[model samples]
Target: QRDRFQTLAEYYRIKHGSIGPLRSWMDRHWTVSRDKIETSELHRLIVALNFPVIYTTNYDRNLEVAFEIHGVEYVKVANARDVSKARRDVPYIVKFHGDFDDDSSLVLTETDYLDRLSFDSPLDVRFRSDALGSTVLFIGYSLSDLNIRLLLHRLWQTWSRSGYEADRPPSFIFMAHRDPVEEAVLARWGITVVTGDDDDPEKGLLGFLSRLAALVEANPSDPPTLESGGELP
Candidate 1:
């Protein structure tokens, strides 16, 4: 039965019965070799979009590297200490799932997730607050990620209970293809699904981002700041 575990967390739980090995595995897998990262077209597009706040569940520092390579000053907050030290002048990269460089900060197993939710950790609190206030754009994720699905579900539940469902800010997800059933489910959560062309998915993504960048540039506005803003670090 121990060998039958399906999830990463479950697999690790059975193998080590602790988070140490999982932490090590993540660190080894996610840590980039170069001090300066080579940015991807997607990463460049994200930087070009100039989103005020970006939240990622990934533990890798690719996004941070992208910002650095583009000469974009950004503050990263992954835990309570980072949150307390986060600066305001620059844009924010909120690492909701912790980072590879910091093992203690990493959230791996089911126990870790439950602990984060139960304690209402700073990351969770900040994410909920940001979700409520901002127009969320989810990229680089799929419905196959149960963790993301559950998180979205919780957010939807919260908004539905707030009694201002009509006034909620719009959220979006970009995907390569559309699933009718999934689209309907996402729609119920107030998240619009954006899909790429069936034949040329990569081109579709590029076109969509290019248009988004143009729009942002044409109608420039102050980027969203944290609730407790401070000077740039």
Candidate 2:
């Protein structure tokens, strides 16, 4: 049973007897890195190039710590309230699977998933709009997470139903692997999969992004603005 392909949330539940208590315990103890996690270089790159990032991660605040360490302005969107206050100029760090500060806020259960299906909440609309509008670059995630995959597929389905046209911005995945079968499936639903090379995908992506940043900055027009009002509907 332990060797089976069980989700992290399910595995935790089986081992600990309850997801809430387990996640709550982990919120207090779960550490993503032991080697003093930092993102000073990445922060400098974004600040120097004036690039806005909307990083969606399931983990804790290691990324936020990195940004704060370098004094780069950022906002964390937990719910509609937080989204409403987020500044337009700052980068957004959306914790789709919840964060450490709030235990009940964690979206780790089957029920939590069902709640998101409605997409009625302002936070849900805000996230879906950004996800559908921007070229989302997924990092540190395997395509195997069914919950997340379903959420993305639903977004695509919603867009199609809403009459979003071809000229709309396409969503992209920045994965390390380039499995043809998986890429085909993602492509079928409008998500472009961009794979980094075998040796160093991160470096490859960084180089490409560096070039992209230069090009975007070189343009005389105003920077591309992510909707800051945060109002859904």
Candidate 3:
């Protein structure tokens, strides 16, 4: 299993023998079934805090469903046209990886990643700009994810060579367990490492997010407009 394809594209190519099959598989698994997600405290907190923008790699529509359930207006941007026409009045949920509704837009293979990287696609540009302008808080990610590490490295490189490094905004990652070595490396990349207790890590993370939500609620800033950016706790 460890030697299996490193990307979904390759996995589907070998297993199902074609992209069509792969797309079908993704549609079957990732499509949102319910009109609304069973809102957890964390989801409710996110809706209550109301960040200006929420970027997700997930193909599922859980975030959008949550917004709908709460009667919060939001724009879901998954392609170039969406980005081009995005408005600032409501929160924007950017689905960078791809959305289940669009098979052509999915980025599931190494080829897809390379294509996006080569062209510096609109989504890529949007994420880079947003990352540079605001404080990014990474959640539900693991240190073992090479893609995220590479992205962080690129961001750090950009900041380091920008000459305004002293004024660069800090990024953060929430981890379930404390790994001193990983923490040190992330610190070198200008990322602050926030960790929860290993014992009952999920509960700890929930508490942490709840506290963050409370902070945002108590100090609600104006929603970030199209011309401006906002920070996530």
Candidate 4:
């Protein structure tokens, strides 16, 4: 039987003792040219959102390539030192999970996930700080991820104890499909659920992002998202 709980990378590490070979394989196979990356609608839609900072758990250079291909300026932040390189003029692409460029930073193994669960890493701290004052819209998350769920609960708990929950800015989750159970759980955390009906997950995400992109093109301003500023607990 296949182990369904742990990620494939974690499984490989447990069985073979190291992910060196796997990482090398991915480096060779996952690499793409800037021209090719520019064609991806996922990249285009994301760039169009024009947020000051974009956070993603992905390790690849997809976002960076997309920004370059689209002629948008962006800085990739993978660690504390990179944070200093970020400027206010361009968007910041934060690699929340880790990046391929840094082997020590990749959150591919089980151990890495456990570490992230603590939610005290430099990147996590940065996220918590930014989220406290910015509107956030989470897409491409299953919400089944324990790390993400715990993070959400922590945010909710913070607002609840702040004696200003009502003043808390709204947060949104965009899902391909709606589940009553998931919605109910997230609702208590003050996260609004949005859905798409395109049948295909990629298409569904594209549709939602397209709308946001359109809205941005019409008005050069912040796209409607969950506002996060409330008095800190």
Q: Could you report the Cα RMSD, in angstroms, for every candidate shown? A: 7.0, 6.9, 5.0, 4.7
Cand. 4 TM to true fold:
0.86
User: Which residue pairs collide, candidate 3?
Assistant: none
Quote the positional error of residue 108 for candidate 4 in Å.
1.3
How do all models score by TM-score?
0.80, 0.71, 0.84, 0.86
Residue 231 accuracy (lDDT) in model 1: 13
Model 1 misplacement above 4 A: 1-25, 32-39, 117-119, 198-201, 222-233
Cα lDDT tens digits for candidate 4, 69-133: 88999888999888876787889999998888887778777678887888898899999888776
lDDT tens readout by residue for model 3, 58-169: 8778888888888999999999999999998999999888887787677777776667654377887898899899988888876776667888888898899998887887
Question: Candidate 2: lDDT over CA atoms?
Answer: 0.63
Error of 3 at 226 (Å): 26
Clash number by candidate, in order:
0, 0, 0, 0
Rank by TM-score, highest first. 4, 3, 1, 2
Deviation from native of the Cα of residue 15 in model 1, angstroms: 5.9
Instruction: Report lDDT (Cα) of residue 143, candidate 4.
Output: 77
The candidate, 2 or 4, that scores higher on TM-score is 4
Number of clashing residue pairs, candidate 1: 0
Candidate 2: stretches off by over 4 Å: 1-21, 32-35, 39-55, 199-233
Question: CA lDDT of each candidate?
Answer: 0.75, 0.63, 0.75, 0.79
- Kindly list the per-residue Cα lDDT of model 2 for residues 119-232, writing each as its tens digit: 666666787777666666555566776656886688778777878647557666666656789888887777777665445866766654565466567763744322222111
lDDT score at residue 11, model 3, on the 0-100 scale: 71
- When 1 and 3 are scored with TM-score, the better candidate is 3
